[model samples]
Target: MSTASPHLQGSQSVATGPKSHPRLEIRNIHRYFDGRAVVDDVSLQIQAGQVTCLLGPSGCGKSTTLRMIAGVEMQDSGEIYVDGKLICDTMFRVPPERREIGLMFQDFALFPHLSVADNVAFGLKGSKDEKRLRVEELLQKVSLTRFIDDYPHQLSGGEQQRVALARALAPRPRIMLMDEPFSGLDNRLRDGIRDETLTLLKEEDTAVLLVTHEPEEAMRMADEIALMRGGKIVQQGAPYNVYTRPSDKASVAFFSDINVLKSQVNGALADTPFGQFLAPGIADRTDVDIVFRPQHVRIDFDRAGKGPLPTATDGVPARAVVKRARYLGHESLVEFQMDYDGSVLKVTVPRVFLPEVGRVMWLTVPRNRCFVFPA
Candidate 1:
């Protein structure tokens, strides 16, 4: 497969839409196989020069949605529009090549027989000079101009990946579809390459829809995140909004480790070892889970075997014995056994603060940080 290429000067422009139309839009797209809905009513929009990440776990229909948008796989039902112009639907369709969409996948897929310049120029159509100029411009943009004459086998993995990126951008695609494009690189190389790729894509002013299962990748690269699950988009928002204000317990758990305290709601409140948590609107006697991340749990030294005083935000402090603690480079993860209940709760403390096992510690969960979800 060919990687997407950057736009050439004077190449045909994509169809324009009214000022209100997004750069790319999918309306209630659905795809199914073997009587199962692989992609269910997934819809999203991407503005020019923005990056939207389709984030989810494996088998969650992320790739299926990308394929449908690329026009590689037809959706069972829905419409795909570019610049408010209908490009695809059940009855009307546009060829993948004509849609001016660029594609880059996990594998670089550079042609073994071609040089870096040729590979980048593979998707270009014009005079010889025009193609060469386009390839050179893209190579320079990716910082691979020095290796233009080298073959794929001669370059390092990172270099090869840059070549793929250059080739993808060479065609000057209006929209770029990347499916785990950075997963193939080593951890050390992935971050740098990802940053570079983001810069180039943004400079080109191309709307991008990147599909990845890694939350870290989505958080780092996306301007907007579409959280997918069971073939549906569970949430869509800015990374900070989505991470800090998740819609459900599962959404909270997806981004990081969470400590859940289960309790029955009574009088719009759920009582726990920490304190009473407001669960307004939940019926009385309904089971609810109070969720908070490990990082949000504040640790305090025991005051003569007594916990700290309760506050409106921090709530009442609870005593727990440290069960285990491990230093994880940047932070230390400490597991605690609650004195009231034998349940284990994990807490992440910044830097190195490894308390010995059986050490008593006071724990408090900020009331504002806790999420009350029905069990």
Candidate 2:
């Protein structure tokens, strides 16, 4: 996916950010049903002209948050702000028509009975000539000008998605909210539609908030990601930052795979089965868990004289026999069993450096790279 549009400045651009207000804020939003809290005290902010992705598993309240922002569902207690204006509040429920927001759904919610042009013009509130012009402009913007007269049933999935997007944009709403816009298409079509949708949204300078569960999808499309769990936002930040420096174990596991090492706290030195490792500080507690990515663990099969030693500042002595090695095009994923650890660690290395299956190797952990947190 392409980077954020050049028009999207940093987060501090409230006074000078894109066409909308400094930001779109969802503050302390709560929603419940059947006496169960589906969305509990969640909040997020979307910058103008940047995609803020709401990512979580199913039933995590992501769709409910989108619906509340679109005025389709009422919030139990929070407020929705657009360009700094209060559009949603518990006391004053604004009708969907008056929200001045654009909504694109996963099903391509189009009118089968209406032609493409008429379907887009359905949301427009203007004279016949003005509505016709708006529809024509949007159709051209979405590259569906040739299919303008085709009925929804005759159009392809991508074409239908484009039509839905065109209809959402016909009113020129200040903000746009999309719920899984590419959920129904095949992989090839989904990728194309995603790129096309993003391009059009950028050209129009529309502020967007996309809800999705696919990690790669969110990483590719979002300028920032808000990871939700248990009815609230557990963490939110730039994709790289959130992926590399997660605040908690749950947040870390949510984005990527990791290996946790058990360490014994002894002042500044943490002793482990692999080797004696030192860190910045340690709690008085005797037990701690350290997490690190597979790429960070350097593998050594050849050592000078004393065999491979755990000489790394915080390295561990992991005696593992290579169990399996799968060669990918550019890299190979090597899985091995570490002595009696009861867990296998998979190391990803360049395909050019392949090791025999029965050979043993030393596993080293860098002191500063390991992430330590409460178990």
Candidate 3:
């Protein structure tokens, strides 16, 4: 509950990424169904050879938006471009088969009767030997060349997924759209296949727009993530920036443990329950919310006679009771109740800082380490 004295410095830098430009663009896309906007003015671009994940809760328009791009579902009004060529507009709508876009649905969509080679060749239009060559090459790329003659039922879930991907890539489409590509497999297989799939996509030089509801999956796989909420994109950025420096309260607390402290901005200092935090006028407003990660809070044992200020720090004091203590091998999470506002807060500390249960400790948080946004 005690606020750490402010000491750390903060840095601001421009958002930067690879120099590649986007290859697929969805401009002012709007899709409506059953008298509601399933996709509301959603627009995003995916660069070639990079994975762009559309992440959100269920019913957040991610799948619908992807389906719209694939021509599986028609948008009420919008434009879809593939490699800078207009494919969908109000006047003309391209059929899914003619869009030159590969689709990997949630079901994997492998035909039960077709062998791996036959399934991959289903997308190709060529002589028998040419289709066979393409299928065999893709099979090797996905590490499934040995399963060429095997039926879909004979393969493991991961193998089937690899086959599905190979089939999608057979025609060498301009873009690939994947809907929860690894959802059905067990955790272990899912992790392995996720890595393998990404490697295959990179090797194939395929631009992909993947849709998933899992944050961990998005963080691990995506070069950039576009987070959706209520049929709109709430935020989109690289994984680290989206997770650490979120723009709003909804985004900050969506998938992380955040301590939202009420603070008043005054020139360089913001007063919170913990202490007077040093905050530059980043928000450029008098009233704003300061968000701090529990992991950034530094806690140390308070000895009876060590520091000059016995129980107070920088004219601010924290009275807290150690409510809970948990050790998880690499680190420990400590929880306490702040006396100032009766708020429960937690701090993740390295294993070396493990304090005993019911122990009283003082904590300090450098203001610059926290982020501020409008409440």
Candidate 2 minimal-lDDT segment of 10 residues: 1-10
Candidate lDDT (C-alpha), each: 0.89, 0.77, 0.79
Q: Estimate each model's TM-score.
A: 0.94, 0.86, 0.86
Best by lDDT: 1
**Candidates ranked by TM-score, best first?**
1, 3, 2
Better of 1 and 3 by TM-score: 1
Once superposed on the true structure, which residue ranges of model 2 sit more than 4 Å away at CA? Answer: 1-23, 273-282, 303-317, 328-331, 340-342, 350-354
Candidate 2, residue 105: lDDT: 85
Off by over 4 Å in 3: 1-21, 265-269, 278-287, 305-319, 350-354
Estimate candidate 2's alpha-carbon lDDT, on a 0 to 1 scale: 0.77
* Candidate closer to the true structure by TM-score (higher is better), 1 or 2: 1
- lDDT string, candidate 3, 150-189, tens digits: 9999998888989999999999987899999889988888
